[model samples]
Target: MEYYISNFSNVKKEEVKIKGSKGSFIQWLVTKDHGAHYAVRRFTLEPNGVIAPHVHKYQETVIILKGSTKVCVGREVKELHENDFIFIDSGVEHAFYNGMDPLEFICIIDYVDDMSIHPVDRSCI
Candidate 1:
């Protein structure tokens, strides 16, 4: 299979903007164009940064690489720390938020087209 390798530091970081949120997120990614059905990216949330509850047409997962975060699924909220992993089923409403310190994690999701992936926001909290 055709392939490529990249270090997170070698990738570009992007900002995350939830429709009605005050804080934002940033990411470093390894996309599917290199030959994979899914795309993975690292997300870093500034204090109070929130990823409004959103649904994925496809399943999604994230691993806490550093720092900690607060994740919400349905009505339950969970705290995640380094080495923790969170899995979200397709169509499930989920989101991430940071506490006092910045939080960071790596997210994995099905890859469709770069422009077609819009995580639909839903009722969170």
Candidate 2:
């Protein structure tokens, strides 16, 4: 078996460019190229940042690492703080918003053939 080690400091943070997204950054910790069946990503949102409502084919689990965020999943909205986590089922619409403090979290998802994300209207959330 192969082993991989990474340092968050060495990972490059890329700006999130999805339509309607603002002040969000993403860092890929593990990817398919790394021989990982699942991809692990770290996301950081600047204060008041927002990730627009969207749904994807792959499900994901999000673990809050720092600060706080308001998450809208399906028809439910909840505030999450550090150490809080949530699971989002496949095809479920979800959105994230940072509060006054910057929000940071880790997301784990399986690498799937269809990973395309479809945007959902804000009114749907």
Candidate 3:
């Protein structure tokens, strides 16, 4: 068994590219434990940042931690604040926008055995 705590002091921050966008930021804190082709990541988005619309072959769940956001799943759009959560089913186009200051959340993605088989297409942005 593996155990770990991702305190802000030890978590590494990285930038995520937003396709066709001028500016955006995403910080990630990956957990130490890995499940069957799945992973957990703590993600933070800056104000006005967007993840862009895209779809994956696997499922994903997002748990909001701070600030607020507008999430688009399929054809529906919903505003989410702290303590809110959302689930994105496989093959559904989904995206997130950080509209209320800095947004922090955790994203858990379940994948198949080979990640290469489930390529992420970012053409719908």
Q: Best by lDDT, which number?
A: 2
Candidate 2 lDDT at 15 equals 90
Residue 39 of model 2: what lDDT?
92
User: lDDT per residue, candidate 1, 1-125, as tens digits?
Assistant: 47677787777776676565446665546565667778787887788888877665777789998788888876789999999998887766777878888777888887543333345546555
Backbone clashes in candidate 3 total 0
Give the per-residue lDDT digits (tens) of candidate 2, residues 32-116: 8888899999999999999889989898999999999889999998889999999999989999988899899999998778988
True-structure RMSD, every candidate:
2.7, 1.4, 3.5
Candidates arranged by TM-score, highest first: 2, 1, 3
Error of 2 at 114 (Å): 0.7
Report every candidate's CA lDDT.
0.73, 0.90, 0.69
TM-score for all predictions?
Answer: 0.81, 0.94, 0.76
lDDT winner between candidates 2 and 3: 2
lDDT of 3 at 14: 68
The TM-score measured for candidate 3 stands at 0.76
